[model samples]
Target chain A: MRLRFRPVDTSFYDLFTESAGHLVRGVALLAEMLSDTADHDNVAARMREAEHAADETTHSIVKKVNSTFVTPFDREDIYALGSGLDDIMDSMDEVVDQILVYEVKVLPPELSEQVDVLQRCAELTAAAMPKLQSMKELEEYWIEINRLENQGDKNHRRILAKLFSGEFKAMEVLKLKDIVESLEDAIDGFEKVANIVEQLAVKES
Target chain B: MRLRFRPVDTSFYDLFTESAGHLVRGVALLAEMLSDTADHDNVAARMREAEHAADETTHSIVKKVNSTFVTPFDREDIYALGSGLDDIMDSMDEVVDQILVYEVKVLPPELSEQVDVLQRCAELTAAAMPKLQSMKELEEYWIEINRLENQGDKNHRRILAKLFSGEFKAMEVLKLKDIVESLEDAIDGFEKVANIVEQLAVKES
Candidate 1:
């Protein structure tokens, strides 16, 4: 083990935790958007607000990193992790927006399954943010997130195969495909954040 | 400008140039894939080879970064640039593979236009890699890439609108959309590389 001066800044953790909190809300909105009775316009409007709020959290992380004399981890790692979280929100928001603008009347049930994966990833990620301070017991967080991402990947291919299975109209397939991909992108974004956290743990350890 | 001890390791630049060189070939293969009389299998096979070769170059850059004590630029930036180039190849390869797998026939002419933008971006990137050492007159390279990216985006939206225009069959639309998005992704990959180069120059200056 290497000994170094560790200056503790609790706000970074607090801000990251706050950031993850927004994702929790964001995922809920995403789940709501997938509901059959979803008010597409209302859900999408709220999603936009949630995404903007997530962006603010990201910007706060950046500002804190710039102003603070010492960061909890590396400056670059902080930026990567912060932006990684923000990217997830952007993807989720894209899904909602696609559902709205494309006027996709019926979303496949499998999409909800993918959102379920995102919800789990979000919960895991939210639970893991504060754990950044200890850098202990972090491995399981990334490992589980990776597992969920793999499941999401499987779900994605299954969805695509179905989309091409001659069930839905080509036009509907076109619109739904965008939503599906955005869902996949959001899941991938979570995996990226996990990777960043994992890397941070490795560097810290 | 800040004066810092700059150690020149020509290999990193060479490897980057070599990586960008693969993109040039990759884009050419992409163009060939779009031809009316082109052998889709052969073009796809060649693209796979090009992608594999690009992967080797990326690995070489990583290995060199790990072994070399003094790099030309930041190690992260080097990794980012090398992988950025590699990602473009991956997206191109994906486009080719999708065409082959989906058996998409009669591709839209708009796709060829997008590939034209990619070819231009690849050529400019290949031209710009050597300029990393001087970091001079490189602004035009990124500016051109950004301009081409905007052009590609416009082409992408036009292609999407056309795909959704009720002309092609839904199944065909599904197939072509994958190829179209992959092409757009490749162009976006180029823009990302340019952005990385721009940031590198800013850091160096």
Candidate 2:
């Protein structure tokens, strides 16, 4: 029987999985924030909590990487992945915050489609985090993310065009544009995390 | 006498300097684009050429990093700094393009102040690139950038407030906000480059 001597710190995988878990929760809050009946203050407060939780996960990952002598992957890659996930959360939180602070009462219906894209991305990212151990099946994760990002881009343009299509009042357009861009940034953040995972996997392989 | 054997490739310095030089020219074009009597088409054409030139410099730096082994600093830092500089040019280009494509007339005068900030950052960056070799006097470069970024942030808020102040028509506010945000992004990009330089300096020291 062959024995593995330098056992990779498997906790890193768990931490990453935990990090993605925060994103899943954060995205759910984002979706809730879009509803017409939603309480803006209540949702924003919960989102702040979710964001803080995501930050805790990120800091845990960073602290672990700094203290551990032998990490599962390159320290930089670990840091990038950790913070990349955090950035997505930040973007999501920003979307919710904008919706609240901007006092934007009427959101375009098209924004719901963007939120759907983000939900799918969060789920896919959560699924992919655990598989970092085997470095197996991450290709599809990134490929799908790239695909979703393209979809998000199309949605983004459509949303922008709609905003500029003389549909909404100018003040509303100004407020919603910031929110829409934040949603796009969140999706792009997912793709960035997937790319980091792809790079790490390639180097490991 | 002990002889130094592992000579660092110094061309990276020149390439970075060349990259910053492109930014100086790009910002000049951006300033010209703001002139009311200026021909948008002519200025946009020149800006495109300048952007392409910046891309070439970025590619050269990436190619050189890939081909040459003995880099002066970490390869990743080189990549970050190179792309960081490239990103600023992109933001500047986007501002000019938005002005042209949106056919935006009567740019807010506050925008010129933002451009002044960018011009200073470009010059500071151009001055700081060569100093990477000795890792000396770069603190002021980044410190000034942070200060400038704060100034830019203040300007951004003021601009947004003015846009929402009911002074301009809704359509005009929509168009001008995009341009204003792009200008703010360019300034932020400069700060990002400075941060990379600061990190590289710390690591090398």
Best by lDDT: 2
lDDT tens digits, residues B1-205, model 2?
9888998654999999999999999999999999889899999999989998998898888778767757788776787798899989988998987887767779989999999999999999999999998999999999999999999999999999999998998888888888899999999999999999988988988
Q: In order, what are the TM-scores of chain A for the candidates?
A: 0.94, 0.94
TM-scores for all predictions: 0.68, 0.68
What local lDDT does model 1 show for residue B108? 84
lDDT of each: 0.87, 0.90
Q: Show the lowest summed lDDT stretch of 10 residues, model 1 chain A.
A: A196-205
Model 1, docking class: incorrect
User: In model 2, what is the error at residue B68, expressed in angstroms?
Assistant: 4.5
Q: List DockQ, one per candidate, in order.
A: 0.19, 0.17
DockQ for candidate 1:
0.19
State model 2's lDDT: 0.90
Per-residue alpha-carbon lDDT of candidate 1 for residues A1-205, written as tens digits (9 for 90 to 100): 9776898655988988989999999999989988999899998999899889989889989999999997778898999999988999899889988888888888878888998999999999999998988888988999899789878976876787678778888678878888888999999999889868865654454
Best by DockQ: 1
